[model samples]
Target chain A: MQQRGRGRIAYPYIIWMAIFIVVPLILILFYSFTEGDIHNLKDLKFSVSSYKKVLEPIYLKVIGNSFVLAGISTLICLIIGYPVAMIIANTDVKHRNLLLMLFLVPIWMNFLLRTYAWMSLLSPNGLINRLLLWLGLPKIEIMPGKTAVLLGMVYNFLPFMVLPIYTVLSKIDKHVIEAANDLGGNSVITFIRVILPLSVPGIVSGITMVFLPAVSTFVISGLLGGGKTPLIGDLIEQQFLSSRDWHFGSSLSIILMIMILISMAVMSRIDKSPPEEERRKI
Target chain B: MSKNLIELKNLTKRYNDMTAVDSINLTIKENEFVTLLGPSGCGKTTTLRMIGGFEDPDEGEIFFEGKLLNDVPAYKRNINTVFQRYALFTHMNVYENVAFGLRVKKVSNDEIDRRVKRMLKMVDLAGFEKRNVDSLSGGQQQRVAIARALVNEPKVLLLDEPLGALDLKLRKEMQIELLDMQRSVGITFIYVTHDQEEALTMSDTVVVMNKGVIQQIGTPEDIYNEPINRFVADFIGESNIIEGVMLEDYKVSFDGLVLDCVDKGFALNEPVDIVIRPEDIRIVVNPDEGMIKGTVTSVVFKGVHYEMIIESDKREYLVQRTVMFPEGSVVGMNVQPADIQVMKRGDVPCSKEEEEG
Candidate 1:
């Protein structure tokens, strides 16, 4: 009875979720299946035309580009962030917190502000080109393209990758590593045979955290890509706001959600498989 | 006599201002079950780690098989350790954990499989090859850890209190199994533990330590019957340690009574510490029939024996006997000459002072 009474305290939160989250999702589902004025219930008629339009070549390309760019950005973050996390975790306690704080300092600022800061640096007459010219290097052209967009995604999401991996790596028992050394494993071999396998759960969560945000970000593509590269996120935004095509936008949003759910399912499977089974497959 | 497998020449380790292991020399023979036994922070584990090549001694040399091993890394040394917590890799299965060392050396698949299977079988976990390490109980994980280290067949196995986490009954059972395994394997085992009984039960030689220094190194019988100091006597088992004066060879005087003892080599009238084991003190029904008389203060039933505390000359003596002496009853306590152990007074504080401190 006490547990039941305590559970009632969550009723307010449940109602808030129903009104804010569940209602919007249901409206989007309804919009995806109907055509006509959204404000008028009688004018809305059931239709599959928005779903059919999603299958078009142009829209499919936008969806494909979003996934490819997000995948590359997530990979870059893992490559750069993993070593940084390991270094931070291995440092003595006196400096570990300071290093972690430094890594998180940039994240405290607004996300959009950070992306806009990248734009000013990557522009044609930007600080980067000025520094390159001063160093006797040729000016490079990288902005207003997928490369700039990818850079923005990686820069914005690198901390997401590092934090979880650091938490896991730091929690590993020192004795386990010592045991590995006692079992004739050198530093490099011990990392492969023990530490890396143990940190897979962190890697999976890091991938999800970085990839989900990178895939759906419209601000980075807008500011860095200079309206030249349009991803699925930009396409969906244009449909709802500029084109006034809520039906097509809702359909695209549903597809993106399904895609994310599928990727998450795959990531969880990788996390759930025992490290021994993973080795056998290799 | 067997050959000396490992030797420590004044090994010492320090952590900043505090010394963890003081300068101490030791020799461990091949095929010997040696236990570095002591209370926590007594440097037993630190000494074991130095031998395992996990910790480098600040001052002194380690000789393994008569070779200088000062600069040898842990991985390069031909020794393995079963950590106190077992330290089994949680990401791996039982088979993979046992096969870890073999795979590190690039042993053939068939050889690894055969050796891992045999090791698991030896630890009595034959069919648990594919079981996840985290799924096992504490005892099973302990067995897997032992299997993992033993499969490598290192010349020496350093077990850092392998049974410290088990229940009392399981610990007792594992003690017997470990002794049997050591005999069958025929390798030197350097075990570290704070439990004196476990050390006495399993070790061929027990090195009793206190404050980073070895107090005594001897067989269980020798350490019990012939402790060299007050610390060893108080640590190994229940004992009534009292200050006494040596009258001459084969005699000592304590509490205004001269008693016959089997210790000598001390100068006449030298102050010494006398150790009388609780079980060694016999209670006589007739007060005058014994050497000393005291009133029984308390009695406690301890399964196999009755433990009684007797007050004589304002000093309490702990006595263990099969027969119960009721409280407030006057009794005579007698100790044989052989059971009375005497040693020169050392710097270690007495049990009473230690408790007060």
Candidate 2:
């Protein structure tokens, strides 16, 4: 009886999603295929000029730079976050909550403020460089470049990577690990064979979380990279706001959306098929 | 070679102030199916974990095949466990889970395949090599767990209530199958369970434990027919424990009535506890034909027999009889001499001491 009424309760959420998610996506698609100001679509003419403009060498380089930096930051988050998640998940119950809170506390701060903080720290004469100089180390230039942007991206997205992996790791049945040991598997072998494979869902979600925002981040690049490294997000923003070219900006958004979707599909497919096939194999 | 395959000497484990397994000394012979039977918090699983090297005792030494194994890790020790929940790798298929031990040993793939298939076949899961472990039923998962443990050919196999998840019918079937598997594998099986019937049905020796101490260790018949104290008698099966006194050699008295019994170790006129199995008491229609007379207060149909609570003048006796005696019916109950077991009152290490002292 309760189940019959449950469907009605979800109607509000369905309507909200249609208005917020599906309608906006359809609008973007419609704008990407037409030429004119998006708000004045009454005289809009359908064309491929925006898509043609997206493949230009300059915009293509910006997209490539976006991919490279985002990929690097995501990889770094995974490397740093997996062990952090593992340690937090494996900690005793009393300390686990505190450790997780510590990892997530930075996320509560404003995203732009966090990036600006990194900008100050990565400046040429900042605290980190001063510390390096005091230690008789060579001072290095970091800010106003890809390194600074990467640092900001990694710092901002790390908690996203850690939380999901932690959830998966902690939910693992401890007896399964003991069973592995009983089967004569050492710690390393048990982790590789049991723990790691079981944690794939978390890892995949963590990757998506870190990668998606990192790919389209305009603020981090603007604040830290000082416009020296313009990502696709910056290009799209320039077209929409500065250059007043909604068609080009909408096309970039469409491409970014497609890329995110394709990657997610590829990742989830990678996550699902191998485990299924391995289990199905005799 | 040592006669015992595994020996635990003065093993004790404590969690905070509460003792989990206190000074347990047990020796397991090779190829013996021994069960650690007890109540839920009775240290049976703790003792099994100690043997499996999952938990090290706070005080004591463990020996495996006469070699000191106190510091041996679980993976290093030749011991495998079938956990209560089966603990089969959900990410792996039946074949992979079964072949896990061999693959860890770095055995040849061909040999691993052959042995995994053989083990699966032995467990009656011949065609389930490709099935995911979570897709299998409770009984099938249990079989997979057993197969995974046995395929390693460990010297000892520890089972921590592996059949507890299954239904009664499946539990019974698995109990017999486990016994058969133990016989065929010829490895020491140290099974843990709270169910007395499962322990009795499968184990060659049953170690009855309670509140961190072994109450008694004996064969099923010895445990049932000659339980050392009230705890073992009550834990193993239903029994009518009446306070009694040993009158002399081969005689005891309960409820102001003298009765002939086989036990004779107690001093003359000394306090004792008498245990008579419910099935041992014969319910008769004539009051003059039996030793004690009572009116049936309640009768529960227990499939094979009727469990009737018969109230005599001093105490109530649970009598199991195939002959149905209606409630409120006056009936006579008879106890044969050999069926009555007498033991010292302060024998169990449980609450019996607090109660009787």
Candidate 3:
């Protein structure tokens, strides 16, 4: 009886997933294997042309560009986020909560609005250049280029990196750190040996959260890369919206889905270590 | 001349307006196993941290082998601590955790391997090196922590309630193991705990503390028999503490009866506290042979003895005897004059102090 009741309570979520998630994914798979759009499904003919097009040098270059830009943004976020997490985690309770709240306040706004906010700061004659010229410095051009897209991605996804790492760092036992000090490990050695290794799960999750969206994002690249440097996301969008090649777009979407699954598999593999009590029971 | 391994001269520590450790002086000799025994918030841990260089004293100096060491950081100090929760490195296996201190010192691989194996064998964890620390039980983790700290071969070892996490049976076993380890290592061990039995069983000297101050420092026998104040008497073990008037040297009055005791040097008619161990009172069958007559209100059969609460004319007394007595039965209680311990009244008069003895 209890099992049936639980099943009933989960009915809504199950139905929602089947309709909004499973059905669309199946439709995309079917479209990727066929030669035409799905509106006239009965007349569609099966072919492998879409898959072959994905291997062509033009599409491969776009995928490579996407990987490089996303990888750079993820690296920048990790380098900048880890220290911010450590500082917040190490502060006293009263100040730690306040600092974490301040870090999260910017993320409360819409991601699009926040990206536009960065655009205003980075554009040529925008707030940053105006301030620099007023201070007797030459105005520099960074917007409408690869730098702008990388900066926007990092700025938007930074909190995703910081929050997980902070949660892990804060949950670390203070006694463990003290034990390291007691064992004659100085600050640097203690961090490298104890703190960094323990924070691996959080770092892995942060990488997944940042890298996936950075690889498949269209808005940031469209606005900041200024139609010159097209990522895989832009190519898919162009194929589906302008060129009316739904099969090619579906193939790109399938490849993006595979990349996401691979990242998810990596995250789950690192998270597979059972908690201490459960391991003992086993 | 004797060697003093560590000395604290008027050491003090304060947090905000509350003084965690008051101005206190202590001397630890070479290779001595000393324990700080007290209840919670009694500054035992604060004092230990100061000795380990985890905290600095606000007002005086710490000396190591006649050299002042007030400014040295914890990593530079020649001491290691086994924390209360064991603090075993969860990311490392037992072998790696025990080898951490040696690796930090840049020891060679052969030497590290030899020392790690020897220490593990000393802790009776010889074949468990490859096991993850998290998979081990609480007692095993504690042993690994000991091996980790001892491998460094520090001049002193500090343990802060290291047995607080184990079961009762495991705690008892660990207590004996820890004492043996201390003796074999021949290093000064400064252990902190609130368990009087643990302190009495292991230490060469017990420093009793209360309310951020040192109450008394002596051997186990001295602490049990000659508690300088009422707090020491009540905190250390079970005691029937009662109020009394010191009539003169070697004479005291309580419960409308005067008794002769071994204490002296108090003013005539000075109000004082007296402690009598429960086991010291003898239960007699005949009222004529006993000093006080009472009826047994409650009786509980403990493992080795029967603890009975007797209500006399003046007050109630907790008496422990080997034989059982039925509840609501009339009984006679007798006490010897030598068993009556006299002490000075410490702090203010509280209700807990004025209860039945």
Candidate 4:
């Protein structure tokens, strides 16, 4: 009877999630394969045309460009953030909390507010252009292109990259580092054998953090990419908002979800590829 | 080869406002297993760290085989340390962990393989090469740490409480294994531990320290049987300390009993502290015969011996004898004059006081 009561209490939260989350996901999935247009859904019609139309040459490039931007951003973040996280985690300091807080300062503000600030800085008379002009250098055009899109994405996404790497770095034992040194490893060798392998979990999390958002970022592309190239994110936004074609938008959303799962599957496979020895310690 | 493997001269370390290690001078000879024994915060680890070049002394010179190691970093020094926490690389497999030092020196891959295998075999971890370090038990992990340190073939292996993390049964087992490994390797080892039993069981020489100062340096027998002070005696083992006085050269007086103790060179009637080990005190259980009449207050049987608390002159003294004595047995205890250790208070060295027969 007591077990039944406890089970009843757990039922409501699960029921709430199923009603709110499961119902919408099922509706989206149902519309993804059915015939529809900008005006209204053509009922009693089932066709693969809606799914197939998501693959026009322009939309394909959008998907390709999104992957390039998010992938490059994630790679760069790994190179820059890993070292910074190591320095933060390994440093013996009295004011470590302050240093860490300084690293996380960008996270405290609203995401849209931060993006707006980036726009103000990257404009023609912004801080970067003015600095260049003051140095008697050419006023290079950096905004409203692939460069602006990448910069905006990186700026907004640095914290996600930093936090996971930091968590894994901090958890690694110092004794292991010393043991590496004791085993005849100098700084370079220690970093390779001890530090790098241990921080793999962080690296995986950081990559996922940067990769997922980089691929689906509609805001940075819309505000910075200047609509020169419609990204997969922009296409989905257009289907939902501009085109008012819920069926087509649902189809695009399903494709994005499928791509994410493929990437995640590839990642977990790569993580599992290294047998026990390579992964056991990492 | 130089006679001494490592030497520290006037070594001192300070942390902001606190002095962790005061000026210390000592020579550790080659192939000798020496221990820096002290209680917590007694500069033993600081001393070991300075030796390993993990820490720099504020004012001192360190010599490794007559070479100055003043500006050398830990990597430059041919010394490996087994940290108290067994600092085995959590991310590396057992084989990779052992091969770390060889790989650091950029040894050939074949050589790294052979040497790592040999060292692992020496530590009795042959088939565990592919196992994750964290998956191993504490004792196995400790062996991996030892294997990692020893594979480097450093001139000196410094251990900071290598067995401190193990259970008592495992710790004792490791102590034996460590001593055997040290003998086989035939390298100078600078071991640091507060456990006097571990120190006494392994070291050829014991360096007792207290409050950032070297109190005494001698063999385990000397430090145990003839401690230089109350601190040395108390720190090493269970010892009874009694406040006494020096009546004349070679004579000390305790309570109303003037006893013949073999320590001297103080002025007449100078107050001194006398230390006697528990087992050294012989118990005489005759109804009418013994040195001083004492009633047995309590007896605690410890497998092979009885820890008896005897009360004489309103002062309780603990005595350990192998005989299984019943509770409340009236007995008299006597410690030989040679067993009585006389020491003065304050900062001072051991005096060569002559004893009068």
Candidate 5:
């Protein structure tokens, strides 16, 4: 009886979830399976055309581009972020919090403002090119291209990768590392055999955190890509607002959700597998 | 056993302003099971870590088999440690955890498997090779830690209170098992623990430490029967310590009674501390026929004996025997001449301060 009363506190949250989350998802599902005026229930008839339209070659390319870009950005984040996390975790307690706070200070500002700042710095005749000219170097084109979008994704998502990995690295028992040293492992071997494998869960979560956001980010691609490198997110946005095609947009959203779910399932499987299996894979 | 395997000369380690291990000298022989026994913060673990190459001493030298090892890192040293918490790698299986040392040296897989299996069998963890380390019980994890350290077959093994986390019965069982393992392996074992009983049960030489200094180092029997100072006598077991004056060789006076004792080499009429073991004192049936007379204050039943507190004219005495003396009963206590141990008073000021603190 006590547990039941305590659980009653969650009723408001459950109602909130049903109204804000479940209802929208159900409407999207209904839109994805039927083609009609969504505002008029009389004309809303069951159909498979919206789902069939998602199989077109043009849409598939956009989805592939989204995966490829997100995958590359996540890989870069791991490569650069792992060492940064290790360095942060190994720092003395007096300075570790300061270093972590410095890393997170930029994130406290508005996301769009940070991206806009990057845009100003990377634009032609902007801060970077002006500095390059002042150094007597040739002018380079980075903004209004795929390179700028990739840079934006990496810059925005890098902290997501570092924080989880740092958390895991710091929580690892110092005795375990000492034991590795006692068992005749040098620093490099100890890191490879003990620390790296132990931080796999963090790496997995970091990948998910970076990849999910990067894939569906329409703002960065739109601002930096100059409407040239259209990703799945941009296509879905255009379908809803510009073309006024909610059915197709709803279908694309469902497909993207399914792809994310699949990737998450695969990531969790990797996380659950033993370190020996991971070593064998390497 | 005759050959000195490790020698520490004036080894000292200080952390900031506090000296954790003071300048001390010690020699550990080959095939000896030596235990560094002390209470927490006594620097026993610091000394062990210095020997293991985990911590470099701030002053002095550490020599292993006649070679200077002060600059050697822990991984480069030919020594392995079974950590106090059993520090088993949770991400690995039992087999992988035990085989880690061999794998680091790039040993052949067949050789690693054979040695790991044999070590597991010795620790009675056979058929547990594929099990995850986190799935094992605390005692089982301890055995794995032992097996992991022993698999390398190093010249010496450092165990920092390996059985400290186990239950009482399991700890007792592992103490015997560890003794057997040490004999079979025939390697010098340097163990550290705060548990005096464990140190006594398993070590050939017990080093008693207090306040970053060696209080005494001797066989368990010697340490128990002939502790060198007031600190050693008081720390080792239950004892009645009383201030007394040495009248001459073989004679001491305390509680208004002069008695014969075996200790000498002190200045005549010098004030000294006298230690009398509880069990060494005999309660006489007739109060008038004893050297010291007292009234029993309290009696407690301890599994194998009865402990009674007797209040004499000078102080209360804790006496242990097979017989129970009821409260308020008048009793007389008699002690053998050899049982009265005389020690120089206030040998170390830190321990005195510790007592007061």
Candidate 6:
């Protein structure tokens, strides 16, 4: 009886999604073909010239750099986040809930605001540099560079990596771990062979998160990386803001969107693979 | 050579306030299968985990073949465990899961393959090497867990209720399978469970425990026939413990009846509990001939036999016999001198320690 109205209940959400997401995306696709600015373009002419402009080396270089930055940040996040998550998940029962909340709390902050906050703490006159100068340390020009961008990428994505990995680690039965030790697989061996492999789903989820956001984000690069080091997001934003070429920006956005879709498709393929089961026969 | 394969000397584990295992001193022999029998939270699993080096006893030293195991980590220990939840590798296929320990030890690929296959076949799971373990049945997963542990061929096999996850029929089947495997391998098995029947049926030695203390450790028959205290007699099987007074060295007065028991060194007029297994008491059809007269209050029809509860002097005593008695059969219950075993009241570690200074 309760299941009878399920489709009707979901009808409103579907209509709202079509109006907000699907229609806007279709408009973006259609706008990529429009020619010239509105004042000069009394009659709109549809053409593929905007797409040709997106294929230029300047735009492609930033896309490539975005991939490299996202890749590096993902690697660093996994290395740092996995162990922290593991310690939290497997440690004393009394403190686990608190640890989980602490890790999760940072995500509630606004993404753009957090990136700017890092800028204040990383600049030459920022607290971090001021501390180094006070300590009689060499002046470090660390802020407003590729390093800052990478750091921001990792910072924003660390929780995404940690939460999934922590969940998987917590679900791991300690009994299986004991069994591994009993079978002569010590700490290192057990972690590498059993724990690591079983946690691929979480790792993959983490990687996707850090990689996708880092690759597409302009806000961090603009605030911390400075305008000199262009990324795909910054390059796309420039076409609309400074260059005033809406069609070209739309084409670049389409390319970035396609890349995201491709990666998502690959992740879905992996996610559909076999579930874990340890077969015991008697 | 030291006959004992593993020994726990005054082992105790305390967690801030609660002591999980308290001074448990046990010895297991080479090639002998033993079961630590107790209810949940009774430190049986803690005891097994300590033996496997997964847990460290707070106040004891462990010895394996005369080698001290104190401070030894789990991996360095030469033991394998079949975990209660199977604990089979979730990510790896059955073959890889079984082959994992060998790979870690850098065994030759050919040899690892041979050993994994042999162990898998031994568990009756041939042709399942490539199949993902998650795709298998519960019993199949359990077999993989066993194969994974057994393939390593460690000195001792620690199983913490390995068969507890299975259905009743599967559990029974696995019991036979486990016994067969144990016989063939000749490896010492330290099985932990709360099941009395499983322990009685499979273990060469059974250790009964309750509330962080070992009650008795002996062969199945020894534990069954000569339970050291009231808990053991009650735990292993149903026992009618009657409150009595020790009239002499081996004589006790139980309610309006006096019976000769085989116990010594009790003070005169000392309060005691005489424990008698239901099967030990015999039922006679003639009400006048037996030592104690009673009427059948209820007759239970157990398959292949009948168990009757006898009521005499407002007290109930169970008497199990092959012959079925009618619902209202007026019968007599008697016991031979050899069958009536007696122990001091509240002698067991668990039940009688309610109020202590």
Query: What are the lDDT figures for the candidates, one per model?
Result: 0.92, 0.90, 0.89, 0.83, 0.91, 0.84
lDDT of 2 by residue, B167-284 (tens): 8888889898989899988899999988888888999899999999988999999999999998988777888888899999899998889999988877889998899999999988
Query: Which portions of model 4 show Cα errors greater than 4 Å?
Result: A1-12, A37-44, A130-136, A273-282, B347-357
Best by DockQ: 2
Better of 1 and 5 by lDDT: 1
Interface root mean square deviation for model 1, in Å?
A: 2.4
DockQ of all predictions against the true structure, Cα-based: 0.59, 0.65, 0.49, 0.53, 0.57, 0.53
For model 1 chain B, the run of ten residues with the poorest summed lDDT: B348-357
**What does candidate 6's lDDT look like per residue over B1-357, in tens digits?**
428889899999987799999999999999999999987778999898888887778998899989899888888888888888787777778888888789888999889879988998899999998887789999999999888888888889988898887898999999999999998998999998888889999999999988889988999999998877788877777788877898898788887787887777999989877878888888788989888888788988888668888888758998787887786777787887778777767746444221111
* Fraction of real interface contacts that model 3 preserves: 0.72
Model 1, B195-259: lDDT tens per residue? 88898999999998888898999999999999999999988888999999999999999999999
Give interface RMSD (Å), model 4: 3.5
Please, what are the lDDT tens digits per residue for candidate 5 over residues B1-357? 279999999999999999999998999999999999877889999999998888989999999999999999999999999998999999988989999999999999899979999999999999998888889999999999999999999999999988888899999999999999999999999999888788889999999998889989999999988888887887777788889999999999987899999988999999998889999999997999889999999999999999999999889999999988899999899999999999888755424223211
Model 4 DockQ vs. reference? 0.53
Candidate number that wins on TM-score, 1 or 2:
1
Provide the TM-score, chain A, model 3: 0.92
TM-score of chain A of each: 0.97, 0.93, 0.92, 0.90, 0.96, 0.90
lDDT of 5 by residue, A1-282 (tens): 999999999999999999999999999999998888888998999988988898999888889999999999999999999999999999999999999999999899888998999889989989999999999999889889888999999999999999999999999998899999988999999999999999999999999999999999999999988878899899899999999999999999999999999999999999997777325423
Worst 10 residues of 4 chain A by lDDT: A36-45
Q: Where in model 3 is the C-alpha error above 4 Å?
A: A1-4, A266-282, B328-331, B348-357
- Where does the lowest 10-residue lDDT sum fall in candidate 5 chain B? B348-357
lDDT of 4 by residue, A122-188 (tens): 8788888999999999886877788888888888887788889988988887766766665666788
Q: Which of the predicted structures, 2 or 5, would earn the higher DockQ when compared with the native?
A: 2
Give the better candidate number (2 or 4) by TM-score. 2
Candidate 2's displacement at residue B268, Å, is 3.9
